[model samples]
Target: MASIETVTLEVADPTAADRFHTAAFGLGGQVRLRASEAPTTGFRGFTLSLVVSQPADVDSLVGTAVDAGATTLKPATRSLWGYGGVVQAPDGTIWQVASSSKKDTGPATRRIDEIVLLLGVEDVKASRQFYVDRGLAVAKGFGGKYVEFATGSGPVKLALYKRRALAKVAGVSPDGTGSHRIVIGGGAGPFTDPDGFAWEAASPALTN
Candidate 1:
């Protein structure tokens, strides 16, 4: 089965982005950085999510990110879905730190359970079919609203959400232009999706 191996974020300063990510999330090799002068504005059509164990973990991660130069879009708060907060990285990428549990079972730690790449697409169903044709199996679906792909042991899980809705969730405007400034390194191939997100063949070094 095809799975995402690594996510490459194109930033103006690779060194700075590397420092920020390492200090903020300690993501290791699953997320990579590349130098680029890509012209991008507004939302950039997606958000990266860090899923943690509990509310305290959410706060911990969010706090660390803010200290690492990330700007908070939404303060961590309880909601129907649990606790979450949104932040924008200095390199112009949006990240959501979230948890499904309202209460903490233990002391907070910076352990992240999952990293999800949520693409904001115009049509969830069409993007879903497009990925399905590319060998990604749907793990869950919510009509035409959302779809998540099975990642197995891959470092990052992939999911789709309507553009406007996703922007609202991330507390950003849906309007964006220029390159997505992100690339998916996976088993899929060197193809661009309907939403213009690029994908490349996975590199063995990315897992090393």
Candidate 2:
């Protein structure tokens, strides 16, 4: 069984990137990927990389994504990274699909190591069942309010909270357009969850 280990996104403007990261949630500083060393390859926001070994059957691994009503960008295929794919999630975000490779990229530990990404959902029970129905085992924690859905590599943590409460957690005003817009490789769209909390998802842009 393949699972997603990391989720990456690309942003053109650095300042806006920081703002989005801040507004989406207070996942900055501690969770933000360092850019000093890599310079050009610095990360933009929180990443939730999936742990999918077989990278080919991406559709099979992205069951939660599918249930979230993601829009497929490119079906499973081989790329410079590995067998992977991209999708425009229903919440207007791009997601990545690939197997972790500890190659010339340096030791995985050297890379940002921490739980950086958390999917904010409206209904915890429904989301939990959705992932479980797709064969993902829910790992409860934080007194069951928080959960880590197990995948082949690691797991994607599902943080349950109301829209207002979640906005506070993300450290955002919950104002503006009241939604997020994600752009990936010239593709863009709007997305949201059951509770009317919108988001942006896109595959990491190509840069080196």
TM-score against native, each model: 0.97, 0.37
**Which TM-score value belongs to model 1?**
0.97
RMSD of each: 1.1, 16.1
- CA lDDT of 129 in candidate 1? 98
For residues 108-208, could you state the per-residue lDDT of candidate 1 as single tens digits? 98899999999999999999999999999999999999999998888899999999999999998899899999999999878999999999999963432
Best by lDDT: 1
Worst 10 residues of 1 by lDDT: 199-208
Among residues 3 or more apart in sequence or in different chains, the pairs in candidate 1 whose N, CA or C atoms overlap within 3 Å are none
Segments of candidate 1 deviating more than 4 angstroms: 205-208
What are the Cα lDDT values of the candidates? 0.93, 0.40
